[model samples]
Target: MIDTAIPHKPNPTFEGLKRNKVWLASITILILLAILSPAQARFSLAFTLDALLHTAPFLILSIAIAAWAGATGADSLIARVFTGSPLLMIGLAALAGGLSPFCSCGVIPLIAALLSMGVPLSAVMAFWLASPIMDPSMFVLTTGVLGTEFAIAKTLAAIGLGVMGGLVIYLLARGGALADPLRAGIGNGGCGASNLRTPQPVVWKFWTAPERRAKFGREAVKTTLFLAKWLVLAFLLESLMLTFVPAEVIANTLGGTGIGPIALATVVGVPAYLNGYAALPLIGGMLEQGMAPGAGLAFLVAGGVTSLPAAIAVWALVRPKVFTLYIALSLSGAFLCGLLFQTWMGS
Candidate 1:
């Protein structure tokens, strides 16, 4: 009982009229199309749900880490810690990396902040290399999926690799072969007045510094936007890899000795941006299908350390060669850790 005789008044604006017509035409086409391909429609919905499953954990971890960094002043603390003696810095990095659940993606900003705060490059490298493999989140994930024994062994391997890598970087860094745009007193005039930007006044002027509020908001916004943008791409790619690529292919290709494990881990993981939680279920599935524990461990560590987005984030702060070294160091550390896990720990 619609009034088809009279012309219904539509939005007079050009843009509004275009929008209405587009919506109507789209709905009409969809209605006709639905009658033709119901099975395809159902498949599309299922595929979407599976993709969401693959992406959810990575998204959650990234957002949570961003929130934590904003809340805690961990960035500044890391920077201050980085300013210590090279040996002490490396040790601290190993300790901090061992404990924190933060991944490479989340750690980049913290390292940048640390650099701004004056932490040594070696220490930052140590942390970047180890945290993803040795952190509690990764530990729980490895233990739950692989086993407690595997997790413990993996942790030991991470620590050993991290320490050795830190020492190597510390020694090599003295030659100044690597470029470090983030070195102390380079940018922002040694983190003095330049970093202390425009201030916003608060209720209690005497109690709190206006500078802190301004800096906090700026950093929070910056970090959130940066992480969020990368996370979307990471999520999409992760889903694509999980859904399309056969797990067996990955396992078969990456498994075995003679640096095959390391090479495969690096090549595969450099592009696969997975957080600790996002990886566990997928890894569990792979392991059940006969993926070697050591190879799987290597994949997890490499994936976390060599995340493309995280590398880019870090490259924004440091120079290209340093970033390249970071990738090489993380990949090497992951492979060595995997080997050690396979060798030393009791079966």
Candidate 2:
């Protein structure tokens, strides 16, 4: 007898595991290491766990801050800086981008909204350049993984890069080089646009309301999980790199105290970059292997701005000319920042 019963679908748990690329990659690496080199697998696991434990305090603080901001709607304040004079807006936007918690992809919707609302391209460019480099959570994590001084330098670099980009776009915009920056058929960011256009009042004491409490819980869980997976993967990679990659090799390639190494690092950064959080431990490993501080900085800055995801989003959203300008600014700004940082370190 032909039954009309529907076929059972694949297990949800299996499907979820399949979709978690980072975790899958991590597990695969560990399994391969175990099979090929049990000693290295043991060492890598221990290293990853130890690093995670050491970073616990900073991780908790970062998670709380991110979740609190989300629950309280503090992100709305970001829109306020877009008003005022173009120069002032540019400055403020750059500063805000350094401080704001938006990632590269996360900033795209906001960019679309600002561009659609007649906000000057200079200020938008400023925010766009800086938004991916540093944020409160990222700064905290950076301080934990890299040193406080390095984190501070990175934060400053983010703002400086933003300002540089803003100024360049401003001058070119004045010369009529960049008009109608958005690509055709792009809507005003849909859901995210309205939030910027009419921001809701922030509720500082979000715990008072049931919905806000729920939101806080959700945000906290989400942020914690996100950071955990990336950091675990990062520390694991660091362990492998430290064990396998020779110091002399790193030293000879990216270790020299000169602009040449920094430039090479800037170029390498665009493609070699993994994820921003994931890159920290890898950079730490590189530093230990004699990679220069300036090269590290260049890699971080360039990777943050021109990572595949970030660059793709920019290309998809803007006209070709604007996209070209963004790439030019990112590479130049990264090189300049690295050079300045190297000089400062030498001094």
Best by TM-score: 2
Query: Per the 3 Å backbone cut-off, how many clashing residue pairs does candidate 1 have?
Result: 4
Write down the worst ten-residue block by lDDT for model 1: 192-201
How do all models score by TM-score?
Answer: 0.59, 0.97
Computed on alpha carbons, the lDDT of every model, listed in order, comes to 0.59, 0.92
TM-score of candidate 1 to 2 decimals = 0.59
Per-residue lDDT value at 253 in model 1: 70
Question: What are the root-mean-square deviations of the candidates from the true structure over C-alphas?
Answer: 9.3, 1.6
Model 1 agreement with the true structure over 135-247: per-residue lDDT tens digits: 65456545654578877876766666677778887888788865454734335432322212321222333226455556556655754454443333333334345556787
